[model samples]
Target: MNIAELKEDLISYSKTIGIDKIGFTTASTFDGLRNRLVKQQELNYQSGFEEPDIEKRVNPSLLLDRPQSIISIALAYPTKMSKRVTSKKGERRGIFCRASWGEDYHYVLKDRLNKLEAYLQEKVPDVQLKSMVDTGELSDRAVAERAGIGWSGKNCSIITPEFGSYVYLGETITNIPFETDEPMEDRCGSCNKCIDACPTGALVQGGQLDAKRCIAFLTQTKGFLAEEFRVELGNRIYGCDTCQTVCPENKGKDFHFHKEMEPEPEVVKPLLKPILHLSNREFKDKFGSLSGSWRGKKPIQRNAIIALAHFKDETAIEDLTILLTSDPRPVIRGTAAWSLGKIGGDGAKTALQHAIDMEQDEEVRVEITKGLQLIEE
Candidate 1:
């Protein structure tokens, strides 16, 4: 089999199948990534969402037998909404990060990977392959970097020159030995924009991230948001984009290359008050297609309460009071109590006074006290 010719043919086929960028690399163990992951674990910097087995994560051979090559692909997603939602006064909205604006990228990227896998199988009938997207054991950024898809940026995203960091990454490990591409040179010299812009200082330094403090990671947690980070969340209901939005490389990098990645402005930036009352069915009906909904509606609803407080919207006082007084979920009730304090008014104060006595949960009671304290302050 002519391997070089096959590589070129595969690259051409990838473009025809909606893959924005594709690159190939040897399936060698990611030595540098293993060390970094160990350090991150020691520092308690990991988000706990990743595969616990570091060996499986960095060693492609563990995932696929006799893995000879790895192929990385990227699909560009839109940064700006093509259609705009008109803003009306007192109708505060919470924003989802650009990554979660459209259909879940896992499905989108997997479809492309499946096509690539089929193409390889057709050419080499005995080809062995294993594929993964974001939830995969191998780091998408690490594979993409080695495969020459893009350079790893300070924000921990693969920043393609053509697509900036606004890209979804996926990879396939194969027995076929394809020619490799050179890694891109780091273009983030002396630029601290992504690090400096991180709301919770999650970017401890240039390329290192303390995931526990990252708003994007924090937004996914089902528990109560850390008090110190609540104010930092702003109106971000799902993930934080401060780092990517501030990057100079992404200034003019909006791309609408795939229709599946287009945002529905109303759904991505929905009214904050309405989110507070969404039934499970309603939440799924509205946001199930987006990647952000994978964690279910609890975190999103809590963030919506925080967003309402960020706006200090007195209009949402009735909704906040309902949640504070009667919500079955302690996290939601406590978060509502805190938000009511942040959005203090006569009505909020009255609700807090009533809930402090009636609330049974120790944590919820504490939040109610905090709410009352804020009103006094």
Candidate 2:
């Protein structure tokens, strides 16, 4: 079998199947990424959502028997919504990040990977291949970078020359000795845009992130968000895109190549007040297809309360009061208490004062106190 010919054929096949970009690299261990990950761990900057085993994350050999090469693919997603949701007076909406704008990228990328895998299987019946999207052990960014799909940008995203950083990445490890592509040169010379644009200062430095401080990570947390991050979250209910949105490389780079990757403006940016009252099934039915909904509704609801506070939506005061006084979840009740304080008014202050007396949870009580303090000042 001519490996080079097969590689070219695979590239052609990829274009037909909606893969925006494709590249290959040797299945060597990602030594540089491993070192950086270790440093991140030592500094306690790890998000805790990643695969715990660093070996499995950087070493493709561990994942597949005698892995020879890795094929990386990138699919560009639209940065701007083609259609706009008509804005009404006093109506506040919360936004999911661009990455979560379309159908959950995990499913979309996996579908493409599965197709690539089938193509390889047809060519070489005994090919051993292991495919993974974001949730997999392998770091998609690192794989994409080494595979020449894109260069690792300062914001820690794979910035393809054609698609900027607005691309979804996936990879497949196989025992085929495919020809590899050359890695791209870093073009982010002295550009501090993404680092400076991070609302929570999550970008500790170029190519390094303190996940704990990242609004993207914070938005996904299922617990009470620390008071410091509440203000930083603004209207971002799911993931934060400030870093990507500010990148110069991403300028004028919106692509709607895949129909599945297009954003439904109304769904991605929904009314914050309505999100506060969604039943679990209703939440799933509306947002289940989007990747932002993976953490379930609690975090989104909590962020929505904070967003309402950010907007000082007098209209949502009633809704916030309901959550503060009667919500079963302590985090939701507590977050609502803080937001009420931030959105100070006679009614909000009254609700906070009443909740302080009836609230049993110490944390919720503390939030209520904070709310009252904001109103007082």
Candidate 3:
């Protein structure tokens, strides 16, 4: 088959394999994408992920020199999942932003891409084919935009008329040239809802994001969260979706749903007391397969304690007390002390004193004093 026919076959096969959108482009799409990755790394915008290794992540040549074109694939995750919505009451629960609420999309998308690769190898006989699902050096969004599957929104996400930004992107890099798709135009217009809605002011005047200020990054980071940003975290324990939620483009879509991505029913909106009581083992067992779980339990557990502190619920004092003395991670211990203090009362004062006496880490002790004082009046 000619390149045109090959492109049609690839797109058709991709849809049959469960992908929602498919587009084709060349390796040159890296020009703009590579620049973005480098800029983000230079500004320390990557947060927890190691600085994007420019040479490794940016260079398409490293993966395929004779690469004729790229086939970009998009998977629209169900946006109507019940877990995306949280209660507005005092006992608030956190939601895993749509993208992360399911069986790991990376694995799922990659499996489909692998099948496409197998199909192409059999059809093309000797063409080089490599499959990647958001795990590789190429820019899947750039490819998507060029392939006409979507346009990159001002929020820096690929936006499709059907799926918006609640889609996972993957691609197949191969030496077989495919019929090219047209590039999409920017539809953001004068809309600034996404920028204005960002709680941490992560978005700049235009669309640039300061990863350090991004709550998504903050929730994933390990160890002690910066004191200044703690209150800004609100109740987000995993990632933040305020921008997407505020985007007009996402308004009518169903909330993304995938049971594998959700917390258990009881755990979905547990009281602060129950979360503080989760041992390291329990925390691991509860969140092990989650997309956010790769960083281990300490960061999330600490965030949970922070959320408890944020609520300033007096009922959290007993749980915070246990964590102060029994939790293994020093960050968790210190943050728990801070939370207890934030939840101030006679009971919290007593717990804080107990924490101070048992606390071995100077940081924890300092936080205890600071947190206690926040509600001292």
Candidate 4:
């Protein structure tokens, strides 16, 4: 088959594989992405990598050595899959966002892309191919914009007319040259709901984010968190999806199939009490297959304790008390003290006192004091 026929077949196969949109462009079409990377670097908004070079990311030769064509794809994740606002018993209160509500997109896309590559190899006989779903040096949003899959919104996400910014992206770089799609027109226009809805002032004037201040980055980051940012973590233990929630275009759409990648009966709305007691093995058992599990259980478990604090659940005093004295991780003990203080009952105060007496780490002792004050209030 000719390159044009192969391109059409590729798009058809992508749709069959459950991808909502697919578009093709030259690997070199990411010049605008390169510029944005520079701007992000200058402003210090690099998220995944430290000291990222935008110029290299957009340059195909740097990414693929001699790529001729780039295939960009978008998978729709619906807002309807998210839980309703009312906090209730048995209902896991808080947010996992819409995109992460189902199976991990990386595995889903890679399995399908590999099949497509095999099909092309049978027909074309001598094509070189490599695929990436947010894992390669290739710029995903950049190629999606150039390929006409969607326009980039002010929030720095690709916005499709039907799916908005609630989509996952993947790419394929191949030696075969195919006809490229025209770039999509920017449609964000004058909307600012995404900026207005952000609980933290992470969004900038043009919808760019400072990763250092972003809650999405904060909740998943390893190590010590700034005291001021702790309260703003709210109830999110893994990721924050506020920007996408407020997008006018994303309102009332169904995108996910509700397939939890690892099927942890507890993770659908995991209980904060149990999380505080997790051993390293239990942590891996619960979150290993999920995207954020690589950081181990400490960061997420600490966030869970903070979320319990946010809920101010008096019922958690027993669990928090046990964690303060018995939990091996100082971070968990410290966060439990904080949560106990947030709950603010006689029992919570007693737990905080015990944690303080048992605490050896200075930072933990300081957090214990802060928790005691919250109880006093």
Give the per-residue lDDT digits (tens) of candidate 4, residues 147-175: 89898887778888877787788888888
lDDT of 2 at 362: 95
TM-score between model 3 and native: 0.91
Predicted structure 3: lDDT:
0.74
lDDT to native, each model: 0.94, 0.92, 0.74, 0.74
TM-score result, candidate 4? 0.91
For every candidate structure, what is the RMSD over all alpha carbons to the true structure, in angstroms? 0.7, 0.9, 2.6, 2.6
Pairs of colliding residues, candidate 2 = none
lDDT score, residue 187, model 3?
A: 86
Kindly list the per-residue Cα lDDT of model 1 for residues 121-240, writing each as its tens digit. 999999999999989999999999999999999998889999899999999999999999999999999999999888899999988999999999999999988899999999999998
Off by over 4 Å in 4: 48-53, 81-94, 256-266
Off by over 4 Å in 2: 86-88
Residue lDDT tens for model 3, 1-377? 78777777777887777777888876653666668777887777766464256655555557886788888888777655453445444455554555665566788787888898888988988989877766676666767888788888878788888878878899888888776788888888999989888887898755588878888888888878887779888777778878887888888876333334443433444444555666668876766556766677677778888887777766667777888888777888889888877778888888887778778888888998887787675
> What TM-score, computed on C-alpha atoms, does each candidate reach?
0.99, 0.99, 0.91, 0.91
Please write out the lDDT profile of model 2 over residues 1-377, one tens digit for every residue.
88888999999999999999999999999999899999999999999999999999999999999999999999999988877885455798989999998889999999999999999999999999999998999999999998898899899998988999999999999999898899999999999999988888889899999999999899999998888899888888999888888899988998989999888898999988999999999999999999999999999999999999888888989999999888999999999988988889999998998888899999889889988999899
Tell me the lDDT of model 2 at 331: 96
Higher-ranked by TM-score: 2 or 4 = 2
